[model samples]
Target: MVAEDDEINRMLTHHQLLDTGLVLEFAENGKVAVEKARANRYQLIMMDIQMPEMDGIYATKAIRLLPGYAEIPIIAMTANVFSQDRQVCLDAGINDHLPKPVRTEYLYDTLLKWLEK
Candidate 1:
């Protein structure tokens, strides 16, 4: 699952993930992201930190509370790279942080690191 509000980012990520052979699902905002999560099981979630309806942190927290989702990997995909922002994501139960303008190599690496688990 990829939760992102910006169309350009969404498209960019789509293209980036195209060759990975993963069936991707998209949510325009965190509320939709949570809804999708409740309805389906995804191996991993790439979540944007700043989104309308609900932010990634809250969505992650809400998803964490859902049955069967406690151990699911939810990674934050965001431009917020400050130490405190990273800490906030950690506190909210995000498994990892992927800084934005997401480089292809790091994206693959992060996916492998989490999905392999």
Candidate 2:
């Protein structure tokens, strides 16, 4: 899966999973993320909310509309934890939301939990 923007967060997330042997791709913005996700088969997608050209919420919707990505899980990673933000992500068709500065344990748990569904 591709991580969109927030270099430090991406690095920490990637590093934390290095031992797991998961190949991660990075994109600087939602546009690139959308492109990459469509270019390959991703088990999941983790991305920041704020990005140039396109935002995570919008990208998530676009991805959902894509031919083969309707059921693919796209988890929103945002600093905003407001109920409205959560609702917005949900309304946009995102399966789940994770706050920024994501902890390794939570990431692993969320992925496992969602993948099991």
lDDT, each prediction: 0.95, 0.81
Off by over 4 Å in 2: none
Residue 55 lDDT (model 2) = 91
| Candidate 1 TM-score over all chains jointly | 0.98
lDDT of candidate 1?
0.95
lDDT of 1 by residue, 1-117 (tens): 999999999999999999999899999999999999999998899999999999999999999998899999999999999999999999999999999989999999999999999
**How many steric overlaps are in each model, in order?**
0, 0
| 15-40 per-residue lDDT for model 2 (tens digits) | 87888767788878888888887788
**Candidate 2 Cα lDDT to native:** 0.81
The per-residue C-alpha lDDT of model 1 at residue 32 equals 97
Q: Cα RMSD to native, each candidate?
A: 0.5, 1.3
Q: After superposition, how far is residue 88 of candidate 2 from its true place, in Å?
A: 0.5
